[model samples]
Target: MASLEQPILISFKLCPFVQRSVITLLHKKIDFTIEYINLRKKPDWFLEISPLGKVPLLRVKEHVLFESAVINEYLDETHGERMLPEDPLARAEHRAWIEFSTSLFNAQHQLTQARREETYYKIEEDLTKKLAPLERKIGDQGFFEGDSFSLVDSAFAPFLMRSQIVADNIGVDPVSDYKKISKWRKNLLSLPEVQKSVVKDFEDLYMEGIYERGGYLADQ
Candidate 1:
C-alpha cells in the first residue's frame, strides 16, 4: 500500500462547495481530517488558512489551497490516484464538464437557499435548458467519456445530488424529461467508490433547510 498523508479539509456539513472537495477526496480514497466550520461565525484558523474564509480549504503538509475547484485539482495533481485522463483533449473535456457542472449548480440551486418558490422555478427553468447538452453528451455511455469515471463525474455528482432535491421540492420529475441525465446520475450514484465516500443525507441536505413549511409547491 502507498503511504497515506493526512489532509485537513475545512468544511461545512451541507455546503456544495465543501461537498465537491469531499467527493474528490473520496474518489481518490484519500484519508483526510474533516474540520467542520460555521459560516455564520467562521473560525479564525479557517480565515487564516483560506484567506477567503470559505469552507473546503485544504491543508496538506504546510501548503494551503482554497476554492473547491482549485483544491480539487491540487488534490488530483498531488495524490497518487489519478482521476484525470492522460490525453490532452480528454483532460480538456473533463475540465469543461467540471466547469459546466459547477456553473449549473450555481445557476440552478444556490439561490434557493432563500427557499422561495419563485426562485425554485427560475432555477428549474435554467436546469431544464442546460440538460439538453449534458443529456446528449452522456447518452448510453458507461461514463461521460464512455468507459471510466473521471474528474467530470466527481465534479458533477454534488450538483446532481442537489438537483434531485430541486426536482423533489418542485414536484418536477427531472428523470422523466431528461432520461439520459437520469441514467448518468444513476450510474454515478451506483459507483461503489462514490457510495463509500458520501457522508450526508442528500435529500435532507437540499430540502430540509430550504422551505419554511416543507412540502412541494403547487404546479411545481
Candidate 2:
C-alpha cells in the first residue's frame, strides 16, 4: 500500500462519488488537499493516472486509487476508527447497502437528465422503488445502522443532499412518499461532513447544470 503524504483527492465539482470520499475524509479529520478538475477538459496527467477517466481519484504519493467506494474504504481503513462494522457479516451487509446507494445515485442522474416529464416520472418511480427497503430499515435513532455515523450514511448522503436541492429549486421531492427516508435524509443533511462536502456554490452550479442539460425538471 502507498503511504499518505498530504494525500490529494481529484474531484469534479458536482460529483457525488467524490463528495462521498470528501465526507469520509472530513469525518476522519484527515489533512488532505482536493484538486478540482474540469471533466470537460481533463488534463493529460489526469488521464494517464485515471483508468476509467473518472473523478474521485485518490492520489497518495505516487499511487492513485480510482472508484469512490474503493477510495473511501481505503481512507476508512487507513485513518482513525473504522466506519464499517467489526463483524464480517455485518460489514458485508453495510458494503452491500453502500453499493445499493450507488445505484440510487445513477437513478437520480437519470432523473436529472430526463428531457420529458414522462421520462422524469419513470426515473423517479424507479428511484422510489429503490428506497423502499431503506424506508423500512433505517433506524429511528438516526444514521443508517443507528445513532453512530458510518460509511453507509456517507455513501447515501450525496444523493439525499442533491434530492433536497432539487426539491427546493423545483418543488419535487423524491422521498416525499417515504416518511422514514425523508426524515433520515433530513438528519443526514444536517451532519457537518455532509454539509461541507460540496463546493460553496454547489446549489447554483447544480441547478445551472440541469438547465444547461435542458431536462424536464429544468422547466419547473
Q: Rate the local accuracy (lDDT) of all candidates.
A: 0.71, 0.90
After superposition, the stretches of candidate 1 with alpha carbons farther than 4 Å from their true spots are: 1-5, 110-120, 166-170, 196-202, 213-220
Candidate 2 residue pairs in clash (backbone atoms < 3 Å): none
Clashes of each: 0, 0
Q: Pick the candidate with the highest lDDT.
A: 2
Question: RMSD for each model, in Å, please?
Answer: 3.9, 2.2
Candidate 2 Cα outliers beyond 4 Å, as residue runs: 1-4
Put down candidate 2 lDDT per residue, 31-104, tens digits, no spaces: 99999999999999899999999998999888899998899999999999999999999999999999999899
Best by TM-score: 2
Cα lDDT tens digits, model 1, 91-181, are 8887888888877877654445435677766766776788788888884774776677777777777776666656667655555587777
